[model samples]
Target: MYEKYDVVIIGAGAAGMMSAIECGKRGRKTLLIDHAKKIGEKIRISGGGRCNFTNLNTSPIKYISKNPSFIISALNQYNQEDFIDLVKKYKIKYHEKKLGQLFCDNSAQEIIDMLLNECKLANVVLKIDTKVIEVSYKDKIFITRDNSKTYLSSSLIVATGGLSVPKIGASKFGYDLAKQFNLNVIDTVPALVPLTFNEKILNKCKLLAGVSANAIISLKKTLFEEGMLFTHRGLSGPSILQISSYWKEGESLNINLCPEKNIFNFLLDKRNTSPKQNINSIINSFLAKRLANIICEENQIAGNIGGLSNKNIKKLSDSINNWIVEPIGTEGYKTAEVTLGGVNTDELSSKTMMCKKHPGLFFIGEVVDITGHLGGYNFQWAWSSGFVAGQHA
Candidate 1:
């Protein structure tokens, strides 16, 4: 026998749960299904377990998509403020971290509990450990089958997220499904990941590992001013992660190691006032001691400032300000926070998150082409897109 529902939502992530809750609240027989034993595994692991749920600064501009304006309607319909209000209604204690990111003060489980409670109140059915093997539409009904049973629904919502963390069960199921339905899917790549340097660059700065600094990292028009950390493999920090989204293979990153100070003026003053001091010692006062020594060695500006000429000083100052390094590639999807591209947004309705060519079909969250920057913007996209789909799906 086959179970019938008004709406069948694939995946039990944030978007799936929200859509199920909304559909159920409308008195629809909604079924939320997931292959994993535990729901919201990503949510449980996000934000270091505290879960950065939403960003107060969320806007369509924060997202990147082939159709840049596609996010405007959904975001405007259900914005960050609305999600914050929902958090408040659940009495989930949260704190605003820097950059307007809202995180739970207790545990991310608080968020999971809140969503589960909403689903319960709305009478949404949840089925975990259920792998959907097949889906077909006929006679205005969508049919899906698992190992043990078959199910049917009038509406089907695909919230099966992108392939970022495969350890957590991320897959290409959503993209494959879109292609199966004749929908266009953008070429996918890892985003918000760490950058790995080639052997040449890594060998030069291997000893500088564990050094972190407040710097400005840029690739073309995209620039991020945040903390940059040096790892044994390469660079992995907020600043690098942000720029990685904008970076391409063979592109060199222009990093300002000392963005707060004018290195030229600072070094010139040191050369005048403390001529007897070693150049490395003077640089130590400005940057990390180890990094300063490495920089001095790499530039070969040995001996005391008194012995160094104006030309060497200028070279060292320029090196500090405009440190250019070309990254070989990124850490890939293994440690990536999100996938860069997904289902082409041009095929879907912005206001409803429904497929324009097919009625009763919707795609939301990370599965869509829209990808937000680090912080809480991605979660806000999930809420906005899921909310919009639930209204019409």
Candidate 2:
């Protein structure tokens, strides 16, 4: 009635493949299956096809979870250095782009191919385009059935990922499965996504779309300093995306267009040297001409004021330096790079990534509550968590 295996893992993304390969290497008869036609589609399309595989400066501190310390043990067990050594062993040429984010030199396919080759060498069986229709537990075995065959295993690892980039087969199947097993699933939201604005800000963003500037974006006490981009929809680029993970609904973001300069003081100096000169001309020297105009216009300034009072200059300074913009919402999972939450860490083992109460069930990758900052942090989490689960599964 069923084909038996020591381990049956669902999903074939980065985490799934890594877990499968490790399980096989440990002499377990491993089977990895996925509903999608291609395995590692996320890897194939990441980093603009170059695949930002991992971050050299990866630490548990970079990850976000309800239990902030949940990532410690796994990250310690299989760190970024370990994964990098494996990449070195395969001779995959990679380069560090910025902030320790490592990417393939040619294509993301290299990373996928490497994982596939490792899976084959470990004798791990991968079945693509096979959707599991039913899953049930019997005695001490986990029985999972596809349209073609039923698989029985002692261990089941759920690496089904999360609802992000829906066009790539991302879904809530992972969360649903966790709930089916009585595991607590955390509320999820879009992370690392562009923030949309109201009609007035939307028009300004549309007018300044494609314009980018080095900026510091802050929400409450959290902040990110990176390149910010304006889009027709709203705000995007690294700064906005990084802050989006921490930004909540109905919260206004404090954005500093000029991080290094004290604009208020700069204007005071300029007032004496060229009091008659258009203030817009002075602000343009620091910010883009269009952005400067918007700030002046929003503050009810015409920029041609000769001998303007100190009060008027302070308003312009505040508008440029402490610009406040509240996002109506995000672009949603359609454009989100990752999901913010899933299978609560409290219900899972930090060291093994296995369900604490459900003995044989394991959760890893984006399916878990752990989410990392933008860059290669999420990929590192995938490798570390998957590696630890594979060792125990």
lDDT, each prediction: 0.91, 0.91
Candidate 2 wrong stretches, greater than 4 Å: 303-306
**Residues 1-393, model 1: lDDT tens digits:** 999999999999999998998898999999999998899998999999999999989987788889888999988899989999999999999999989989999999999999999999999999999988989999999998989988899999999998999988788888999999999999998999999998877875577788999999988888999999988888888999999988999899999999989888887888789889988888999899998888898788888897877888888987889899999999999999999889999899998999999999999999999999999989889988988888987
Which residue pairs show backbone clashes in model 2? none
lDDT of 2 by residue, 1-393 (tens): 779999999999999999998999999999999999998999999999999989988887788899989999988899899999989998999999999999999999999999999999999999999988778898989999999999999999999998999888787888988899999999999999999999999999999988899999998889999999988888899999999999998999999999999988888887777778887777788889889888877787875546767899888887778899999999999999999989999999898998889889999999999999998989999998899999999
Colliding pairs, model 1: none
Q: Residue 251 in model 1: shift from native, Å?
A: 0.9
TM-score for model 2? 0.97
